[model samples]
Target: MTETVQRPTLEAVAARAGVSRATVSRVVNGGDGVREPLVERVRRAVEELGYVPNQAARSLVTKRHDAIAVVVAEPETRVFADPFFALQLRGISKELTAHDNQLVLLLTEGRDDHARVGRYLAGGHVDGALVFSLHLDDPLPGLIQRAGVPTVFGGRPGWSDGTSGVVYVDSDNRGGAREAVRHLVGLGRTRIAHITGALDQTSAVDRLDGFRDVMADVDPRLIAEGDFTPAGGERAMRELLDRCPGLDAVFAANDLTAAGALRVLREHGRRVPEDVAVVGFDDMLPVAEQTDPPLTTVRQDIEEMGRLMARLLLRGLDRLHPDEGHDPAVGAPASVVTPTTLVRRASA
Candidate 1:
């Protein structure tokens, strides 16, 4: 025995505001050509009557779902375990909410999942997408492009089809790595070793390129491959120690890897910053601050990067739907590479 409160309709709002139904529809959608007085009148009527537009009905006229898809080409385990994605999602959510848009998160695990994601994007279920494709060989970039949905990438995409432009937001990975290695060099550590992330990933490759930029003549034995995980860090560190026991420094690709290196270093009775100096990237606070002697790392604004991704996607969408109040004078959205800064701590 429940009495349901009726929702106000477009007709009710128009009658209350002494305007026609078409006029109310125009005002409620965006008020592009309507006079200010009529817009204000309709607004007052809507506020008083608690009128909410029917999204399904409105979409028919405007051709927008007011929803955005955030597609991550990663397994659920990695997405949940990494703080980087969480912080980035928070920033994206904040920006999307400010604009009254909905977020639909899509995670892909395997080829089957990639096919499903491609269909979802191509189905016209959402207005646009924000994608994260980490590896150079990941087929997601091509899949999404073929879907023909406007997309803004979380990181610089590795694959190029040459038929379309790619828009992305990313940190200065190469420059950050260079800064880290240079800092260790400033400490006068000659026998410097590096623990690189997975070479398949663009971020890892760029960071490795940056390291070589500084240590051009470094011994081949001083480099070890890591997977941007604590376990990978441990294995690489042990290998580096075994191959070059005289190494005076280690530059880990990320904070998680740095933490693992610290553990292995401790196990081997190596005193950090005394016997060897260490530096990391990402400045992930939980790992960076709690590590033994803390970690000197590069700080990239992860949350800001996420926010920028959403903003870029929305702006691009606005450009497509100029009737939704997009300014023609505003230029098309372009790729952005945010700067990275070196955060010094006790580890180095």
Candidate 2:
């Protein structure tokens, strides 16, 4: 049998770098409290010796797993069908990979899965969590709280009690929706309508608030509820046209919904922008650009939001390990609202 090649140990790295084993360990962990010059020396020695620290042993000493859990609470079909989650996952994965942390994905389909997720998080399998797609009355938030794991939400959570201390990242849904409505109004469209997403979601709720902000006296008959799906959008659009044939503008809560509405509008002989100006949120590439006349929509940096969520969670983890030199002030923000911009295209 061939001889097994021995791996370089911490002692070997220390000898190569001309530092004590403890110093090497400290540098390997995070280099907190170690001078810059020593850090470089240790890094160079690690490279030269191909010294890879034993993560299991290191965790035993530092009590950190260097792993993050990403919990996506949505239907499995929706997760696969929508590009939004894929883009966000790309951003989260990139940031976590850069920090040498493992990503543990937890997909929750329903109530039963929520309990399993709670148990896993409480089991101490990860250092922190990034949760997404939370609906109103979601039990995961309370479960996460009970687990005592540091977590950052992907969107504004809808909890009856105040989310005073809860940390989250979300787009300016209200502002974006307002802009979309105001743009339609600028085009002199008086009979404007709003297609709302599932009211149970905070993003959807915020968008509706923005619509109401712009159209304070909007006709109650002009509002239709959709489930943020193409099918829902199609049904809502049909219902709106039957109720208000004179409507000239519509602001869909999301791009997929907008695309569905566009299809129905075409079938009903409505010329986009000429007969009915349409605007959508999310600016999802697949639906927005592929629509017959393209689409004018609100653009939220979905990927950046995902990246920020990961970064915030990592920072929170660092703060917990004060010895790692992380600033406590990093955890001061209770929520971060990313800005949104309108992208003009043929649809509007």
Candidate 3:
């Protein structure tokens, strides 16, 4: 027969420690009412009995769920496919774990989806929220901010309202784009056509503006917008070629666009560099390096951006805000803009 085992209880511990049930309860709950010797007696009894406090009982008093939400306003396909998004997700997940906080990821795209996301954040479902991939006129951020909850941004949606005050982390796109274009110009690639990304995004718009500002002395007809898809880039490239066949080079807004242009240009018997020079952005290694002619592009810290955004949010969550405390250190949220660099390769 197995040895009879005994379970620990508050009354048993109090009896063994020569203390009242109330005193034992205080000790178990980590309260500070009892004197030192009595506290030691309670601890001894607890150790001997192997008592584990009931979590359900404890949480009822604290009212802290110790969880957070991460909202990415993009499609499920985009979230699953994009490496940059993956990096950010990992960073946010790691930081939340290190701080013992749970994370919930929400993808809010459609109008109905947007309504669900609003309730999830504003409903007191999570203690705080971190939102990313926000666009101009995106009302999700404003809704959560008005709820009086601590919110943080993954990037600045540039010209957006109220979200500007939210702490964020972003990479430098304007300078990097200018450098890529200037490099192309230096290589005697005038009549250089550009395939732009989505204009509503600041990254896309800023890159386009940088390209235009650099080429202001040149003709403006050389630019065409692509939706950052290979097909979009191919269409944009064909249109550019049809309008400006004499175009000697192209600076695409991203690697995917550049790759698409390459396919079309090759089909049209245009040689790389020798016929139509090409450069891509994002310096995404596999896409940049695998091209028939490797793509020259701009390098950005995609993973670091994710990690920094999480860190920024964690710091903000560490202590109460100005309204909750007297410390000036917690007054206003912050916005951080990271710098960009150019990585030269054979294609340009």
Q: List runs of model 1 lying over 4 Å from the truth.
A: 1-6, 30-41, 161-164, 319-331
Residue 163 alpha-carbon offset, candidate 3, angstroms: 8.9
Residue-pair clashes per candidate, as listed? 0, 0, 0
User: Best by lDDT, which number?
Assistant: 1
* Tens-digit per-residue lDDT, 267-319, candidate 1: 99999989999999999998899999999999999999999999889998873
Worst 10 residues of 1 by lDDT: 319-328
Q: Candidate 2: minimum summed lDDT over ten consecutive residues — where?
A: 319-328
- By TM-score, the candidates rank as 1, 2, 3
Alpha-carbon RMSD, each predicted model: 3.0, 3.7, 5.6
Candidate 3's TM-score:
0.79
Over 4 Å off in model 2, which ranges?
A: 1-6, 11-20, 23-49, 160-163, 319-331
Candidate 3 per-residue C-alpha lDDT over 1-348 given as tens digits, one digit per residue, 9 for 90 to 100: 999566678888899999998898898867598899999999999899888765455457665556778888875354355477777788878777766677888877666787788877777767778887546667776766787667777777655554556676777777778888898889998888889987767778878877877888666678888977788889999999999999999989898889899999998999998888898888877788988789889888887777667666766766333343334555455777788888888887
Each prediction's TM-score against the native?
Answer: 0.91, 0.87, 0.79
2 or 3, greater by lDDT: 2
Determine which window of 10 residues in candidate 3 has minimal summed lDDT.
Answer: 319-328
* Order of the predicted models by lDDT, top scorer first: 1, 2, 3
